[model samples]
Target: MSDMSEAPKLDDALGSLPGSRNFRLLADIPVRMSVEVGSTSLKLAEVMDLAEGSIVELDRQSDELLDIMVNGTLIAKGEVVTVNNRYGIRIVEVATAEARMAGVERRG
Candidate 1:
């Protein structure tokens, strides 16, 4: 790891580069991700009553889209789907840049 003082500053690194305004550099930027959606709770009785094939219902409705998150930020909304017998989520709508950036800044 390098100390902040020893590392190139953001302005020095990007400002001095050629084609700095191109967005290609950011196309594949990697980031940590996490997600959260509506939740529900079960009592001790319910917990104990659960069986091997039991299903606990979530707070969200079947038609509702789940939130897709990146680095704990809401980036998009997606509906659950099935592809090749595997479960997946298809993004239905994307959050705005301002919203995503606000979330990232808030966490930082």
Candidate 2:
């Protein structure tokens, strides 16, 4: 078996692995996390006609869970929640490791 303790250094803005495969090596490093409510694509003319009170329709239904993304990758699905007036997410489902890797591979 290959010793991950001497794992090759992966260079990127995300941070280096310090020649080890220990998961804790990355536990403290922060990442950009975001919740995607929905998405829509509009033509240039439609976008130019925006007003003060414009309503843009999205592709997902209201009842559907929102996508939870980290570093531009979809990692989970969750619903909205509120705690002490602050909005948060109630995670409903998490993507399998293979699926998450697939997303990362596609972007890479």
Candidate 3:
């Protein structure tokens, strides 16, 4: 019979695993998420001329829900809202599990 007592223990091998448990969570982790809304070539002068209640049309149509994203990845879509004097967005739709996984795979 052969002796197999020299192998390393499983817990010892995995004791140094990396994790995010101690990470600080931020609400807007992806600050550039809304950058890909698709409107291009609008000059700063033109942008500055815009005023409150002036509707600056976006690339998305009225029927299309705006893509809410994080770290440049689409996570959800929703309509804009104002609650308690604070701007908020209501999530009308969320990306599917498979779709989210695919994005992760692409990034990796």
Candidate 4:
């Protein structure tokens, strides 16, 4: 870790950790983040037959934690919550860095 006593370099002062300079370069880049409740594959005909009020059963149980993904990689798991009348997620578990990297590799 970089010594906290020393002043940070002006060009990369935004990063507070060691190697943060490299991370700073990518800070402005945008990646899609999403929350997944559950997923299930259906036949083409079944999908086509869906109409208003149709119900689709997902693979996950109602009480199961949801997946929080960043750039298609699983980063955490959370449960849904209502915040000020809006939907939100309360993070329950965070994925290890190695696990996140493995997810990226699997996607790649």
Q: What TM-score against the true fold does each predicted structure earn?
A: 0.56, 0.77, 0.48, 0.82
> Residue 101, candidate 4: how far off, in angstroms?
0.3
Of the two candidates 2 and 3, the one with more favorable TM-score, higher being better, is: 2
Query: Per-residue CA lDDT of candidate 2, range 17-57, in tens?
Result: 45445655765789999999999999999999999999999
Off by over 4 Å in 1: 1-29, 33-37, 41-57
Native-to-model Cα distance after best TM-score fit, residue 9 in candidate 1, in Å? 29
Best by lDDT: 4
Q: For model 1, how does the per-residue alpha-carbon lDDT over 1-108 read when each residue is reduced to its tens digit?
A: 233488776656776678866644774688875445577898999999999999888898877778889878999998776877997767789999999999889998
Give the per-residue Cα lDDT of candidate 4 at 38. Answer: 95
Q: Which candidate should be chosen as best, given TM-score against the real structure? A: 4
Flag the better candidate by lDDT, 1 or 4: 4
> Stretches of candidate 2 above 4 Å error?
1-21
**Candidate with more favorable, higher lDDT: 2 or 3:** 2
lDDT of 4 by residue, 1-108 (tens): 233458666555665678877878887889998999999999999999999999999999998999999998999999998877999888899999999999989977
TM-score of 4: 0.82
Model 1 lDDT-worst window of ten: 1-10
RMSD of each: 11.0, 9.7, 14.4, 6.8
Q: What value of lDDT does candidate 2 attain over all alpha carbons?
A: 0.84
For residues 1-108, what per-residue lDDT tens digits would candidate 3 score against the true structure?
122477665455545545433222432254655523435467899889888887676676766677777665688888777877987767788989787678778888
Clashes of 2: 0
